[model samples]
Target: MFTRHHALRAVIVTGLATGAGLLLAPTASSVPVPDRSAEHALAALVSGPPAAADLALPRDFGRRFGYRPTLTQGLLGDPSGSCSSPVPLPAEFTAACRQHDLGYDLLRYAGRSGRALPPDARRSVDTQLGAAFEDACSSREEPLSLASCLAWADIAEGFVRVNSARQDHAVPESETVRSIAPGVGLGLAAAGGVVLAVPALRRRVGGVR
Candidate 1:
């Protein structure tokens, strides 16, 4: 029989176990690599004096005239690409994901072409993605939906930040996509077991009362 003290202990244990599960949970998957040809095409398009001209176009210019065909093509190739996260993000996140992909593509292209961008450049891009996620989440109309969206946004941002931390900015992104180590999986499983036990403990405490 569970006493009040035992019930409180179970609650505390459940909280710790849940925290461990979260800490050990594997990060989101790696970003998908665009094709080499697509990368080169995008790189060439963004290079040269005309690139400056392209940027000078209004933000809405691409929406009107297909001004940024490379971006369109890239998004077309991977429409649902939410930074390779398996999480089901809100529809509003698509634009942010597209922009994030463009940023990463630029970094990858630069690295492959031997004109590697500074490490801070990648950090800036990742930061921008996080902000974009917040913006997207804030746009939700309903309060509960907004809160849920924000939570998912945090998860997505956390995944990318962890991924960015592991990356070697000096090299292309292709070299950085790696599977999580076995130890993390074990910890996650242990935490899950503890969390699963909470309901049984709660039932025992309720019966005693």
Candidate 2:
């Protein structure tokens, strides 16, 4: 008795919310400081999801670090300059090294400006290296050193925040994206409901639900 009642109530709540949300969702050309090119591009994707080639273009921060795939995931969740860092990640131990080796070559590009390392920064790197080495060593629960090195690199010290010469935007471009997302989300949810409410669509809805 309680199970059916709850499910019915939930469906009612979901449908009403979905309908109202879609009806009240934002519309085009409402943006105040409209960058039409960006707006058009986003609208195209919202109307239709991006093609694979569209996703192939690099984000600005990712360009800074070149082609490190996990740099952003390593550093931040962003998949940009964070983890798949331009700085070479430390290599895992091999049969020859005996001990775990940090065969990093990424720092070769650092300090092209000839700027001196501040004392604190120098200390931080030294401390991080020590911690990283220790982490990479014992973490190898396996009989081999290679396993430990892999575990530690997941949290190794790969961070350096550089100030970009370009000016930062005062307002977020995401603000516009945010405004558009709600409408698109409501539309999708309503479409999903229409699909779900049909008995013929039950199997597909089961997978989605």
Candidate 3:
């Protein structure tokens, strides 16, 4: 009986060892990974000029606003199309200008931080601007004037979004890595759980003495 029990134990141990060897074996995907540093360096070298231009927000700000008439309307001139005179702007138009400036400043800060607006924050800003635009455009006082102001704000916000870190071509590697690590970690954890369960199989066999 003792010899039989010993033989059974040896078979079980050998099976478990084989199973572990298979589990730990290097699959096709486990082959040596290629060095991406060279590729990344080459890409950065090629993209240097364009990346610099995109980051130069303040320098391009004037030209961009100048080309967009709606953006300059309330900013450079009053409701009566007077640019030189210092007259008080209509309330809605003033608010529009404020919002546009706010958005522009916020975008500059984000650019400096090397980050993009989160979805919730972006959606909130869009919704708020949309609501304000509708209110101002429908107002009885200087409706056309206020409409121009809201249009300016919308254009500024659009520019910010386009130049932001959300652009696929310019997105940081850190962001992509952050998005993928969690799923990979979960897969590894599941595999580890299976490996851990293997040790418990010996307790279930009725032949062990």
Candidate 4:
């Protein structure tokens, strides 16, 4: 009962539908799965250092940028480390601690690898940190907090290339000093002058990691 033209049209329509689905299948499967094991390992490295007042004090600053308290609670808690004197991390800093640890671990990997970050990895860090800076700057809160902005700037300096001429030059000290100066000035008004002594501290901390 089917006319030849009608049957031909039906066959073409089904073929197109099948072809369209096949084309979309690859895109759906191409998405990378979240690497939980890698993230956990990185998180452990972050929490391994003994908790200190200096480490925990940045929580309030992190809060200003919307660090969720519930999610950060256990993540920022104290870890067992060999510290002569240990300071308990405040509940407030949990989110900040986790965020800092993750960022630090990722950048540390890039640094230790002794090669350029893959394009996707580089873009991922750049986009996240850039967006955070923009959000911090746009905050309308009075006596505006720049802690997140400064912290992000510090993290960003590690990955952002300042000197393309050298394939293996360390991140410039001046850039880091400049980025964190505002945070130190705002957070530790009286001790702001001592920030210049950070290069020595950097050597110590760099060795520890």
Candidate 5:
């Protein structure tokens, strides 16, 4: 029977689900687009060698994004991000990770400035990251060390590629969640409806008998 208990339960479940969905949904914010020249320069830096990247650091990039590029152990520094993997990678991979972080930052900078790069831009950056990882492994001369590095490189690249596929290209991380929130909300609502309907359907069948 659809007793008072069932009715109360349904109301509570529906309310919670709807409320959560609303809270999780993304909101839009507007910011003036920075000059295209700055974005172009950042893109070039991401693609170019680490030595050349330092040249752009002192220009409009530092003033606009508050990004002060530093040099660490001869590699470009990425204080804002790093190789955040569950398992430790070879130390040589540090340079590759720093470069990859720069590419992601470019995407974030473009997004916050109201000018988003195309999806292909992200793909291109990711591809380069994988290549960099491979190159790092290739540098190992010892047979065992070479094998181990190559194996880790495969694992790292696979993880990165999969994660990248899940993200919205050139969008800030928070905005990506917002973009997908409505679909998630609708799914939750649908699930709640099914739960409530099952009890009602059972009660109706009992009455007919």
Candidate 6:
């Protein structure tokens, strides 16, 4: 009777060990992962020197709004469009911009430090804004007006740190990953979870490891 019980217990232990071991192992069956990086880009319609040039002015104006239009708009609502346009910044975006100023978003080179970024944070800012504008205009032939251009530029630039949530539906990675590390970490974490869940059963073949 005791022998019979030990055999049953061993069989159960083997099954469980095999299952958990599989969890730690790599699986041959894998899901194709989606790529999501926000390398600070925009619509391909807004590309080239001319589009870049046209987009330049509005972006400059956006930065002038204290290099914080995006941050401000993200946190507090700017109904007056005081920063870049008369068109109010969206309520949610205003809060985000505000959060950015509150040290929610850390700028690497824009300021002396992440918390105490300089007010005249222009050159680096302009470059970031410019790159965003250039991306938005890459594919389209239309030229965004100064206000519209600034609006888009603010959204794109601040997005680098403001972090947008990812959805199952695919959109421009440029827009989504503007928040930097969050997106990268989010992607990697998700991939890790899936990768570690099921390992390749045929790693050694013919038997479970």
TM-score of 2: 0.22
Weakest 10 consecutive residues, lDDT, candidate 6? 36-45
Itemize residue pairs with steric clashes in candidate 1: none
lDDT tens per residue, model 3, 86-135? 22233554544444343333343344444433433334433444455455
lDDT of 4 at 51: 39
C-alpha RMSD values across all candidates: 24.8, 26.0, 26.8, 16.2, 23.1, 23.5
Better of 2 and 5 by TM-score: 5
Cα error, candidate 2, residue 48 (Å): 38
Answer with 2 or 4, whichever has the higher lDDT: 4
Per TM-score, the best of the predicted structures is: 5
Per-residue CA lDDT of candidate 4, range 1-209, in tens? 88999999999999999999988887745754433333333333344432332243333333333332122332332232111102222233334444444443343434443432333433343344344334443342322133333333343333233221132333212345565455444434323422443444334333221
Better of 2 and 6 by lDDT: 6
- As for TM-score, the candidate ahead, 3 or 6, is 3
User: In candidate 6, what are the lDDT values of residues 3-71, reduced to their tens digit?
Assistant: 988999999999999999999887754532211111121211123332332232233333433442222
Candidate 2, residues 1-209: lDDT per residue as tens digits?
67998999999999999999977887553423333332332233223223421343234323543443222111111122122222233443121111101111111112221322223333333344444444445444433333324333322322211111111212111235554454445444544443334443333223222
TM-score of each predicted structure versus truth: 0.50, 0.22, 0.26, 0.27, 0.58, 0.19
lDDT of 5 by residue, 94-180 (tens): 877877777667777676666767777677777877888878767766555665565566566766665667774545354456655
Candidate 5: RMSD over Cα atoms? 23.1
The true-versus-predicted C-alpha distance at residue 112 of model 4, in Å, is 12
Q: Quantify all predictions' global Cα lDDT against the true fold.
A: 0.54, 0.32, 0.40, 0.38, 0.63, 0.34
Shift of residue 104 alpha carbon in model 1, Å: 0.5
Model 3, global lDDT: 0.40
Instruction: For model 4, state the Cα shift of residue 36 in Å.
Output: 4.7
Per-residue alpha-carbon lDDT of candidate 1 for residues 67-98, written as tens digits (9 for 90 to 100): 25234322221233444554345677776777
